[model samples]
Target: MFDIQEIRSQFSILDREVNGKPLVYLDNAATSQKPNSVLDVCHAYYTELNANVHRGIHTLSQLATEEMELSRRKIQKFINAEHDFEVIFTKGTTEGLNLISYILTQKLQKDDEIIISYLEHHSNIVPWQLLCERTGAKLRVIPIDENGILQLDYFDQFLSEKTKVVSVNQVSNALGIVNPIEEIIAKTRKNTDAYVVIDGAQSAPHFNIDVQKMDCDFFVFSGHKMYAPMGTGILYGKREILEALPPFHGGGEMIATCSFDGTTYAGLPFKYEAGTPNVGGNIALGAAVDFMNRVGHENIQNHENALLEYAQRHLLEIEGLKVYGEKAKRTGVVSFNLEGVGISSDVGMILDKMGIAVRTGHHCTQPIMEFFNIAGTVRASFAVYNTFEEIDLLVEGVKKAQRMLS
Candidate 1:
């Protein structure tokens, strides 16, 4: 059985206070707090194995390289990727998406189409937009209904033989809706030869991921969002697709041979990973993955599911409060707006004063905001360490904010 208190104890920051009150951190969608195990791994890397990886003949360098590769393999197993070489180290999801967009654009031509959804974070949207801008490919969108669910009916309307790439988030960062990615991928496979990409930044932390089951051409996620150090991320590509696409960057590590006149790039994962990578972050991310394994994804899901349900029921009880994205299946995220409160920032500020940390603003998905005819929302997201007491505080905080701010 999963012990909530014991699991909470693993994270040291949860004990601290803010604003003379116990901190109720509900801003997990923005970034997660790291466990002490992950932090210790990062600290040990810097203190004990502070050496450059993959080049030096020294023992420290070799150890660093081994640890880094071990992390990659751990990620490979975590995601059920077919081969270790399929996992490429990246700065974060944004960089991974940018790399994929840049590389895929090379294979595109005029009049090609790239499809994305309205639920996408700007990181997923902008890279494809840039790709379309450069390649003369028409950018298509998969629309969403008022319930924050994807309108699959429109997918066939936008898809065609010209469709070259389809990229979407597995779970929305702002609304927390789990997209029908398997259905999307199946339909895309039936219609076109487009390469499918999944932004797993929000999904990887909440549940188990299987790249083989997803069968996506590329899958990207951020380490910081999964309780690891910042600047560590992964880009998982099918072996065939990765080998075929041109490298995203050129540097010392990604090269097999280089001359003043010409350079030949390395193969597989190294081909995409350029420059000195985030050795400590990647190693710590491995520790984070192990931590998740120890706690078990199913257990985490069960706890968070109950928490979200409890929060939603409590939030709906407050008069004039409208919770967005309730009609669809969601993760541990709830975005809402007070009836009279026009500016979400004001509510966020009041919550902060009350020691409740939540995210406010467009959350980088302005299209969704525009869909609801609102500028932004107050998002209270949950994680495994959170409890019912925190939800009570959040509710009281929201009601207080309503009376004070409104």
Candidate 2:
């Protein structure tokens, strides 16, 4: 079990008072607040050892390079990848998906297919659609049940010899539906020559991730979503597949030797990282991972699940409130709409006055909104640092919004 009060003290922003009200931060899905350890590590990196890596032979460069390499190992351990060479750093989740899409399209031929799911974020869907247009391949979407879970039973119908890739989220960001990813991977691999790409942006933060157990061809996640700084992410490709795929970008750091007619690309991880990378952010990511390990990832998940359970039971008591995505054992996420409220945006404004910070909109799954027959939902996502008192305040704020909107 986690020391809940002790963990809350680690986040500096939680101490902040908003308009004489303790801030109620329920926007964990959009972005999580940084803890002090993550911040300290970033400051220490710049103040003590700030040097470009891999190209330097001096002491500062050596220190920087060592830290950079350690960061890679930290990420490898975080996802339980087989090797550090398999992990390639990127700007964020969007960049990771783009890199995979680009590399796959380069390898694919005309009339090939890539499988996607309807529950995916636009980040996962749009890149594959673009790849199809670029390579003359077709985009095949795996349908979802009315409950927003994948209709994984029908996956085989869409796959064939021409299906070269199957990219889907391990957990749906909007619906908080955790898919049976290992089963999906086994089924897809048994039937076709498709490479499995997992969008793990939501899954990485909520649960313990093990790429080896997943047996996935590719796994991608953002550091910011997992308590690291923004603009730092990773893409892990199996060694055999990564070695075979061509480089996604061309630039200074990605080349070993270049000539007028021929150029030799850099090594695996460096090959993916072009030009000046986010050294500070990457160092901070390692710190974030260290902090999470100290707190225990399993403990964090358990605490957050309890918070979600508490919120759900209390949220339903509000008149004219309908909770969406009531799947079995959800993550720390709840999407709901106030009934008889023509304008949820108006409700958010009223809640803001009371210091609640729930998100209102399509939540980046506009297609899902069309399926649910609604414009959007007000989402209140939770994090480990949140307390029962804050949840009570969240309910009070929502009830206040309901009365005002009604």
Candidate 3:
């Protein structure tokens, strides 16, 4: 059985007050609050095992190296990768995508195309843009419907022999719609030889991820979005593909040997991880994986689904309040705007004064905002610890904003 209160107790930040009212945190899509277990593990790493990995022969270095690799293995099993070395440690999803884009510069030629969707975060979009600018490749975008779901039928028009890569997010951060990635991958395989990439940043905390089953050539997600610390993330690539690609950064740990004449690179993961990694952050990420395993994905899904449904139902009842992606399948996010509020940030400020935290603005997807012909939407995203009562508070807060602004 999943105990709501027991789960809430694990996140101590939920107990704090904001502006003299009990804090209701709903900005989870940006970053999640870390659990006590993740916090404790991070502290223990700094206190007990503070040494550089793979360089020193001392006891602390050995222990630190073991813990860091152990974290890599934990992520490997969590995502069901074929090999532990395929799970490369990255700073976050942005860096992972940038690394891939940098390496592909050698492969992509003039007029080669890279496809992405209307729902991607800027991290997924800009790197490809840079790649196109550098390599003389063309960047194509798959359009979306009015309801914020991808229009998969239009995807065929974009797929061709010139296509070299197809990268998309599994979930939209601005609208919170879960995309049809499996179907997209299937269609891509049928049409072209392009490598498929899935940005799992928004979906990793809410659902189970099996990269083997998904069959994407690359999958990337951030630990900070899933109860782990910032500056830690994962980039899982197929071993053969990773081996074929050149190293993104050339530095100390990523080298086999160095001389004035020439230099050779190291093995699979170390090739991508050049400098000293965030050993404690990665260990905390492992602890976060363990925490999620203990609580179970089924429970997380059910609880978050409940929160989403309750929030949608309540928020939509307000006069002139519009919720984006209301008709589409989504996870734990609700983006809406009040009728009279000129800017979404006004609503967010009003909510914050009432101790209701939400995110407002373009949400790093300015194209999405431009598509809707609006500045931005107020986004309230839920996590495992959020409750029905919090949704009630959000409803009242939105109503208050509406009355005050309109």
Using lDDT as the measure, what is the rank order of every candidate, best first?
Answer: 3, 1, 2
Model with the higher lDDT, candidate 2 or 3? 3
Q: All candidates' lDDT scores? A: 0.93, 0.86, 0.94
Candidate 3 Cα outliers beyond 4 Å, as residue runs? none
Residue 83, candidate 1: alpha-carbon lDDT: 98
Q: Model 1: residues >4 Å from true position, as ranges?
A: none
Q: How accurate is candidate 2 locally (lDDT)?
A: 0.86
The clash count for each model shown is: 0, 0, 0
Alpha-carbon deviation at 365 in model 1, angstroms: 0.4
TM-score of each: 0.99, 0.97, 0.99
Model 3, span 1-406: residue lDDT tens? 8998998999999999998889999999999999999999999999999998989999999999999889899999999999999999999999999998998788899999999999999999999999999999999999988999898888889999999999999999999999999999999999999999999999999999999999999999999999999999999999999999999998889998899999999988899999999989998899999999999999999999999999999888897989999999999899999887889999999999989999999999999999999999999999998999999999999998988899
